[model samples]
Target: MPQPLIRRAGSADADVLTAVGAETFVETFGHLYPETDLRRYLAEAYALDRTRADLADPAKASWIVEADGEVIGYALAGPCALPHPEVTPDCGELKRIYLRRAWQGGGLGARLFGETMAWLQARGPRTVWLGVWSENHGAQRFYARHGFEKAGEYDFHVGDTVDREYILTRPPVSFSTVTTKTALDEHNLA
Candidate 1:
């Protein structure tokens, strides 16, 4: 396949974003919820109006990956909203990162993650956080490889169903105290 194109998302792309968001969510976690619950969750979470507003928000950043002119994946980052005590206004959250099953294991997810992280830290390093389903071992390991540690746990609601989610955090790195090499090695980014 040709290399996928990754670009910043805008309000005009809301419909496509909404579709891909729902598709990827169902592809990954549909079995975990009841039919009605899953439908309700997807409708609320991937609503076109909500997506358009998020895309237009200056405080958030989103990127979409396309291959053959079709969106195959996306990543979103914004001000932290995780319900952790240590979270502050300056902190950032990686709200979502999803790629179709066909596109997995080809390093595209990592590339998308790197881009989102760069955007989150562009103003300077601050705490970065994410939430992953507690049962999703592969995702947990992936976050660990990126220097995130399990900081806490919370219940994530999907309609009437609730899922245990691990809140992973990457503490802010002060460049003054840590060398570039050390920081890179710490995050396994080098």
Candidate 2:
């Protein structure tokens, strides 16, 4: 069996991403959604054309983890898409990180998340955010272990099901100095 390898995705991996992403989504959350809704959501979210476009988009980055010649997990990062008012304009988002069930609990999630976080940090976003389904305790724990804190909540539409999701955020990296518009505070002092 070939060892697991993590590599950045390219346009050539669109089909692979579509397949793995669809399967992983179904495997993890299929129970919560009707088949038709699931299919529609998959078609829109993991379509080959959409994945290809994302692969080609300069604003986004996706990674694939392959083991034994099969995609076992994947991660994606890009500019913030969630419309949380607390999020800074230029904040980054850890969009998705999905792994096959057989591949979890063996330290792979941490490795994948670490890589994804590094990618987001390199993009120079002081804050990185992700949305997790409120009932997914394991996922919530996983994000918490990575230093993410509950920032806010929002309604996430999952195939017609409006699920409450917790928006978690963490600083990517600490800088030596941070500048704020303390001009207001300074003015108030005067």
Candidate 3:
């Protein structure tokens, strides 16, 4: 397979972004919700207008992965919104990283994650946090592998269904302090 082209997403890419966002999201979690609820949530969350606004947001740093000229995955990190009272102004959040199932085990996710972390770290945020669905063990493990730790819990509303989510935080710059040459060079990280 041709290597996926990864790059910072621009405002003009909103349609493709919305497509991948909604597609990957539904692929991952669609069965958990009623079809009407899922459709409503996708319209509310990943509609073209909403995605265009998101792409235009200065605080949001986004990237897309494409193969054969088709967008298949995306990652976004920016201003933290985890509702913990202790979260400070300096924290940023790993807002979303959605890839088609065909792209899941291919290391594209890690590359995108690494690039996203480097971007957030460049912004000098003290840390980055993410909210993962409590039942999504794979996602929890993925975040753990990326240096995030479960710091707390929160409720996430997907339309009318409330999901229990775990809030995980990682100090973005702290990974730079490590001196392992192979580790740093081989794995893109914080």
Best by lDDT: 1
Kindly report which residue stretches of model 3 are placed more than 4 angstroms away from their true locations once superposed.
Answer: 174-190
Error of 3 at 136 (Å): 1.1
Q: In candidate 1, list every pair of residues with a backbone clash.
A: none
Report every candidate's CA lDDT. 0.88, 0.80, 0.81
Give the CA lDDT, 0 to 100, for residue 64 in model 3. 92
Please give the range of 10 consecutive residues that has the lowest summed lDDT in model 3. Answer: 177-186
Query: Which stretches of candidate 2 lie above 4 Å from their native place?
Result: 174-190
RMSD to native, candidate 3: 2.9
Rank by TM-score, highest first. Answer: 1, 3, 2
Deviation of model 2 at 58, angstroms? 1.3
Clashing pairs in 3: none
TM-score winner: 1
Task: Tell me the spans in candidate 1 whose CA falls farther than 4 Å from its real position.
Answer: 173-190
**For model 2, what is the error of residue 186's alpha carbon versus the real structure, in angstroms, after optimal superposition?**
45
* TM-scores for the candidates: 0.91, 0.87, 0.89
Clashing pairs in 2: none
State each model's C-alpha RMSD to the native.
Answer: 3.5, 9.8, 2.9
Model 3 whole-model lDDT (C-alpha atoms)? 0.81
